[model samples]
Target: MQKNKQWNVKGAMRLAGTFHFLHSCASGCLLPFLTLYFRHLGLTATMTGIIMASRHMLALVWRPISSVLARQHDKRRAVVVGSLFSSASVVLILLLFPSEGLKAESGRCNASQLNANVAEDGGEFTTLENLPQFNATVYSVYNTTVVTEQSNDDDTAEYTPTPLISNSTRSVRKVRSLQEEHPHSEFLGSLKVMDAQHQMFFLVLIVTGFWEFMAVPLEWTADDGLYEYLDFVDATDRHRSAKIWKQLGAAFGNGGVGILVTGLYCLTGTTAEFYSYAILMILTVPAAALLPLYLRKRERRTSGGFKALQLVHGNSQALLCAVTVVLTGMASSVVSDFLLWQMQDHNATETHMGISLALAHFSQVGFVPLAGRLARFLKYHGWLLVLAVIALSLQCLYYSFLWGPWTVIPAQLLAGISTGAMWWSVESQCEDIATPGTEKTMFRVFELLSLELGAGFGSLMAGFVVQKFGLSVLFQGTALILALWSIALALLKWKIPRQRRINYSRLLAADMTEMSESDSDQEKDWLETAMDDSKQKNKWTMDKPSK
Candidate 1:
């Protein structure tokens, strides 16, 4: 609790907020643009799906490989190298290829014997009249494809691309000189070119992923640390009492931050001169970096009626968290991108978009604290969960049927509220179900994994939706999926009981000494009552009621 109170308004909290901002901004910028770009390349539906699948596979491979490399080498340098290479590849392709609808650049190679008319003296090989000469043949690789059709020594025809470039998947061609090049001559310089016209396009994806890998650790480290180092210890009132106030304060502050983000988004609409997305990414970094420092710097003990973190991590919670994590594990570019496009289609002006966004974020303010109060809030959590699910279902319907951008904004706003409520319920549910001696670190990982799973699911759905009915059809499909999602969650919500939840958070907190009391006896009693309520919501402990 002391930690929470101190962290509420401090530098560390601000850092956390900043990190969230950057993460969102970076993710938001690319998600909206990448899909639109591939369509521009004239890629077919099958090709697009293949590309999307490759990216997801790469993301899964890259993270673990990157992690292993970081251990053996300098982490920062490795990040820099990966990012630099990724960026350079894009820049190079863009500079070289003029974007005139996939023009093919080609050149012809010819060889002629050099005519050396030597003077009477052997040394005078360079006579003015018969200097060795041959015209350097030049052909526009940009116009015609390579010709491999069999013919006489002087014969050639427009290259009918063989069984290659037909697969339609992105690939770089690498041909080696094994048997045929003349041994005495140096290898003819390779006319390196990609099969597809826009080689720079896929590079955009690589650059984005590389940067995300670089940025993730910058913020997640602090988050991961909280769960690993602090979760179990903070389960008790003695150490955590000060932190609950901070958590409450954080809830409000986070809501305020959401408001601020919306305000900024509105102030600078999508078509404005500024790179709005990039600006958001830059601003978010510092906000997230300082959360840990702020937590450690405060000087006073915290005293207040604050919610306690539940200590018991259970099997159900672990399973849910793990599933969520796996779903979200790979990079989620598709769904995120589709959503932005969906929003933009609704004529989301800069300022108007922010309002919707703020609505979405503001809905989250109370959920976190409510999760903290889970010992008492458990059975009731099911109700909130149900409510959120219903709202989510409504959101999908609204999106599917709504014609105007104006209509969609309201649905988006509803999404915000549903998103917050659902997340909070999940958090609390996990705490309620925690097993004995569950570490803070493990809890944090579990939570993140669930989010990852959700994102991945969204990503998978996005690719198929666009290919099937185009954008208009995609909205309807998204609605149907979300409807299914809501129904499933609602059924599960019915099974969780509130009284049991309160026992877990409430009594567990008291047993652990996490409550903080004021010096005054009356104030102390009030704090005790609040603690009791907190325990009731968070604990779900029904073995035996405290005397």
Candidate 2:
């Protein structure tokens, strides 16, 4: 009788599903209400868009810094704690949930402390019955428990927080049981049938990436998923408004997740309810693991912090990587923009490029899992780099100098291949050379700077070349230079030592480290600061925004 433990696909799926729920819910739940919150703070839609975009742009900086912080600090703990901050952000965001939703909520049900924030201790888990005595039609409360046959008398499903609650039936009377404990019984304040519909449909549409990630463990063994994803996606070109529409839907969805979580909090109307979300995010299980180590470090007994980050086997190489990443990122951007340029150059409609770009997302969801194959093949960083440079160079030439806009279809496919392989190469290199506990952060910076700094520079560079040298000169010259650079990277990829290996576990572990949130103020402050910095990137590059 292995109580508290069951191992099987169904069980795994359940556990994994729960994790997936948290992951997706956390990632995509913001948009339904966050902008509304910002508006409450007296910002317009355009202003809100700017703020949101700024936040993403700031992520270019934070992604790396946070990665570094995770490496130096506790990766697992950071994830858990990070979750807390994310949760708190949700609550704060809810304070601004659309008043319409709130008004709709008015006097609907007995939301005990519906107007309140935190519930009393010893009174964990909420239900329609336990809510305030409003005698209304609907009930919105937290700490609702669902008891299944698997539950024990101690009530094990306690900490599992439900994100929302909407009920249609009114309670005949309030039943005060010491605890709602019964075997083979489930608490159904929620519409299971409707929830199943929403969840199943949402799962179908949204969890496209989740199942792919689930296969990571299978990488060490046989993998058909990877190959299949790549084989098909590598051939795709999302060249339609429908394709772009899907991407827009996703972006908007991500934005919506932020808003929805906030709405949940506002619905609660409890004091410090927002703060508690922050607390929950920070207290995710991963963060809890670092408590002892953190406690010791707090006493000045050395924390896991590192002062130096290594590149190239501790060869005292600094800024070399930074420069490399910046250039590579610029190159990647050039790849994207050049294809667009070619299409435009050939009199292709703006709609074509937009659809083509949207196709990139389809490729992303399709290719990432399979991309690992190329990574597997080119286990060495140098080899990976060579492959990337060569692919990108060829792609540039094909689109700019040789083929016309129609050639862009193949160009996008190859670019995906190049990006896929480039990731493997850099990651392989990073793994071989990275300092312990700092790899995530180091790579974070690598990716962020390379992508953003590169795109920023590439856009300008392409613009300048087109303006001064003529489009022909720009395209041909870029191809020639990139070709040479690709050859050099190939030489390097071939030449670098083979001792370094970036295993799947380390990569997964690193990702998991920052999966959680920061403290309420920490995330808010950081995001605000990031937004401020981003505004400077374009709009107010000279002056920082006032906090």
Candidate 3:
């Protein structure tokens, strides 16, 4: 029996970890690439931010509803429902409103390439010699015209009608009529072919982001369930091992899929990449369903109250941590949403972008387990989180000075360390602080209070910043905010007593036993009340008979 129970626990962990991996595989395909997709639609940075912010905004509401359900019913139910909703949304959006803008840049040819291809058609090759390589300015937009005129000492003019040029997602075509009239014109400026595609893309993203947020709470719930299962199996200290498994899954999921998506884009083209991502999101539902099957059905906690609010008010450290997460969220939103565009600006190809992201996530496969070991040795999760914040600040500074596309590779090491450690430490701290019966509630509340709220405001703020000042200023400003947040974290560490901080992990292991005792005590009190009521009724019956 003992051996069987242990095997069951191990099986549960593997299943849960696999689920985490699949979900991340889906996210890795979409989240980092969404900015580029939006740009393909000709939507501005501000509009992208609004779509991103909508997810976090809806998450704030979902957390509360999911928390209530978890407290009132089985936590697994919420997880299952969220997965189904997310799967449906992804499918609907992909089938009904596919964006053509992503396809515009797919295998497009530049003016020089077009000239060479045209020459090849006549069994000749165009040489680079005497080409108007210096005088011509290439404007990339679809259905736009460019006429180039060359002059010699004879005062004779030669006109060259440039083929369509596509730099990124925008493409332009030359007008034959305009080129004929401007035979002597030296240069023709860029003109854009405007359409309703950008607006259509915006509407689709908003709807898609909304459905995605609906599933957010379920993922959190599933993760917490795994941790609680470890505690139940008397493996609380080994919780990091479970997290390591999750990270490993994410590493494989992200790294493997990223490479495949890039490969597919090169082969079948851009439509292949978008459809592949949609399929990944759909796969998340079945993988997510597997998680709930292994989760322990939690005992119901008392429902309906401002537990989240009370937690913030009662715990000064928690409040400070929440504030820091807001800054962290603001910083993260800017980097995750715009980093692709930055890479593109530095002349990175789709394959290069995919590889860079894969490298970053793969780097975490090693760093996350190491951070867990370091946290255990230090015996203080709080300081580890502070260090993670310091790492974030450094990465932000690095991004501010970004010159080459490869520069982002080194910064990703910082990303895995900071983000992975911060989440692990924060969840552990929440477990320690929660009252005996309200563990999941506390975790969910803090997650929303810190991560979601911060992410939401950060996305909104990033849009406005990108619009007004520019992308470079956004990176610098994020670094400055992180620096300030680090100081605040330092102050929080100083104010909170070391003894109190060290006692958290010890207290967490006893929460279940304490809850059991509390339930027994409540049962005893109810029995005593019922016996007293029976005695009073007997006395009243005897007195009435005598009268």
Candidate 4:
């Protein structure tokens, strides 16, 4: 019996680890670069923000429906596998959309023209303000020169020119060109750009919405299933251990794909990030199927829907936790959706962003084990959340003052505390508060819903803020909000007396007792019914003999 129990525990842990690792691997491969990809496709900060916000908004609607379906139908594993497959399919659809943006192409000849003129004039060139026509003519001549040179040579020679436009000068030239173009030409060109931006925005919005619809449920459902399985096998402590593998997977995925994209970008001047995302997601589907999913055979008397709300309403600490989660989510979403954009503005490469994410995830491997000890030392899980929020605020503040792409590295190291440990605290609290039958539903509602709701609102606001105030102000503003929120949270914790911890072990024992008693009663009733039927059959047989 001991051997069998040990085998089951080991097998469950291994399978759970594999599932989390693969799922996180897929996330790491795509999520960090997703905003960068949008930028590459010529999406403005505002458009990207709207698209990301829409995804989270849609998730708020879809997640509840998914949770109910999984619970009522007892299909957590099926839902996980199906969500992975659907998400993979959605990523592939992104490839079919036009990758090139009209805006990105308009300035292609600006640098070449400037470089050629500078070379010809022995380092002095005409001011850009007076050179539109000259530059246009130079652009034509430069292309012609390159073609003639290539034709004359047996081997085709490539002419690559470095951009000489200072950032301020480039902006001035762009605005001046827009203003100085022939009125009708300008109108027509502006109209064309607007039409394309709007078209791409809607296309990306729809794809992102569908992608989130499929991807978001996998996390909650898989966690619920794995947790239930672990609880059933009396190995619930191993749940946190599984996250170690998840962190490792994310590290490898981000680092490996970042390197891959960087190398490919150098060679081909384009990235294969989306294709890599699709492949990783597809691979995750099979691993999800291998997870140990515990499905309840009997329906609960209490409905799973709105249970999280009920818990929050009844428990003061739970309410505080929910609010904290929302604040954390809001701050973190702004960072996740736009931090890379900010880094790129500072001339950060894909490699820098990738390494930053890789280091953050790798740090989580060390932090996950320490979460429990920290919580213990603090005397409450909520304190860990408070610390995490502080760390996040500091991270955002650090991001606002970035001097170079490499500077983003140190900030990412804080992710272990901000993201990993924060979630660990949240999950631990949810487990403590959840009732036996509604564990998964409560987790979905409390953790996922609150986080996503804040994320949606944050993204919506971030887009406009970034568009109007710039990335620096956006990060600074986020830092301010988080810092204030954390301070308030700490004050509240000090003011309120701590609630006595619920004895979950006793609760579980009582729940088991009720179930066992119910089973015994059911067996007794069945035995009585069988005996009565047997007696009736014998009586009927005796009467038939007389006939």
Clashing pairs in 4: none
Clashes of each: 85, 45, 6, 0
What TM-scores do the predictions have?
A: 0.53, 0.40, 0.67, 0.72
Cα misplacement distance, residue 191 of candidate 3 (Å)? 25
Model 4: how far residue 461 lies from native, Å: 0.6
Evaluation by lDDT, superior candidate among 1 and 3: 3
Off by over 4 Å in 1: 1-198, 225-335, 343-355, 366-380, 436-439, 442-448, 488-547
Candidates in order have lDDT scores of: 0.41, 0.42, 0.61, 0.72
- Winning model by lDDT: 4
Note each model's CA RMSD in angstroms.
16.6, 27.6, 12.2, 13.6
Displacement of the residue 495 alpha carbon in candidate 1, Å: 6.3
lDDT of 2 by residue, 442-478 (tens): 5545665676656556645664564455446655666
lDDT of 3 by residue, 1-547 (tens): 2465444766666676666666666566566776676655445677778877887788777766774565455656455556655654653454354333322222434423222223323321112211243123222232123322222223211222233323312333243345566765323422223334444555667666666656566665665566666666766555456555555555554455556655654344334445655566567666566553334355654552377558656777777667666677777778878877777666555666776777666666666658768887877888777877888888878877777767787888776667767776777667656665466566556667656788888888888887788778888888887877788788878888643333444544444554676674664455568888999999989889562
RMSD of 3: 12.2
Worst-scoring 10-residue span by lDDT in model 3: 122-131
For candidate 4, the TM-score is: 0.72
